[model samples]
Target: MKVQRHKCMNERCSYDQQERIPFATGSCSYTHRLARYVIDLLKAMGLKDVSGLMDVSWDTIKDIHVRYLERHYSPPSLEGVDCIGIDEFAVKKGHVYKTIVVDLRTGRILYVGNGKGADSLDGFWKMVRKKGVKIKYVATGCMERTGCK
Candidate 1:
């Protein structure tokens, strides 16, 4: 269907012929409903794994997820967090180590990192400084570095 557009009075305007459509879509190619549906299934289906089921390219599914996150998600604020807990846990009996930082007040996982050491919490430290979060108490467990640094 052709859209009848009107031209601007100014000859210098680049977009002189502009058409307004009530059914125009946003920058995202997918419709709002389809995008939401993809996001809903994304958690369980996954982008790479869902490409076959959705019959779309892996990159397309990945882009859809990126757009979904950009529109709906924001990093949680660490402001007002006074207490935190950091611990290193072994996966498969010492083959892998992961460090996790949690908010003591709300019990939310703030940061996760591979390899346990002082540097494991570096990501959290940087975010804390940027967010101006003051830590009054910290409970750490099993800080032994297993040479995974």
Candidate 2:
């Protein structure tokens, strides 16, 4: 068994690093402290525009997203899951669209795609097929105007 230790930064916080050295005079853990530090740096740098700047590339957002996702997105092994719920929503009206699929039983978000068209759903199906998942049913819905089928 493996254990991960996190040091708290807040002086009054109840939790402490049980296995390693405590953080230097802080109440939150090392991870929380690091996040606060990064946010403060970004704010001090006058980075008001988080979406698309010369210095901040898509890769930067993608990296942060992927890292955070690896911590949260857990897809169950395709063994008995047969029912899936699919839906599409736009980032903004008439702008970028994204599709989402959820496992009906586990209530886990399974897939995400960049478009609301049938092509996006097809791409998800292709990936699942390639992975040899036994898909018994797929229920999908779209916006009233998209007419996705």
Give the candidate number with the greatest TM-score: 1
Error of 1 at 2 (Å): 7.7
| Regions more than 4 Å wrong, model 1 | 1-25, 40-57, 69-74, 143-149
The sequence of per-residue lDDT tens digits that candidate 2 reaches over residues 28-110 is 22344544444445554533343234344545444444454576566545566688887878787759888887889899777
Pairs of residues at least 3 apart in sequence or in different chains that clash in candidate 1: none
| Residues 33-75 of candidate 1: C-alpha lDDT, one tens digit per residue | 7667788888887687788887888887888888778776666
The per-model lDDT (C-alpha) reads 0.75, 0.61
Which candidate number has the best lDDT?
Answer: 1
Error of 1 at 18 (Å): 8.7
How well does each candidate superpose onto the true structure, as a TM-score?
Answer: 0.69, 0.45
Q: How many residue pairs clash per model?
A: 0, 11
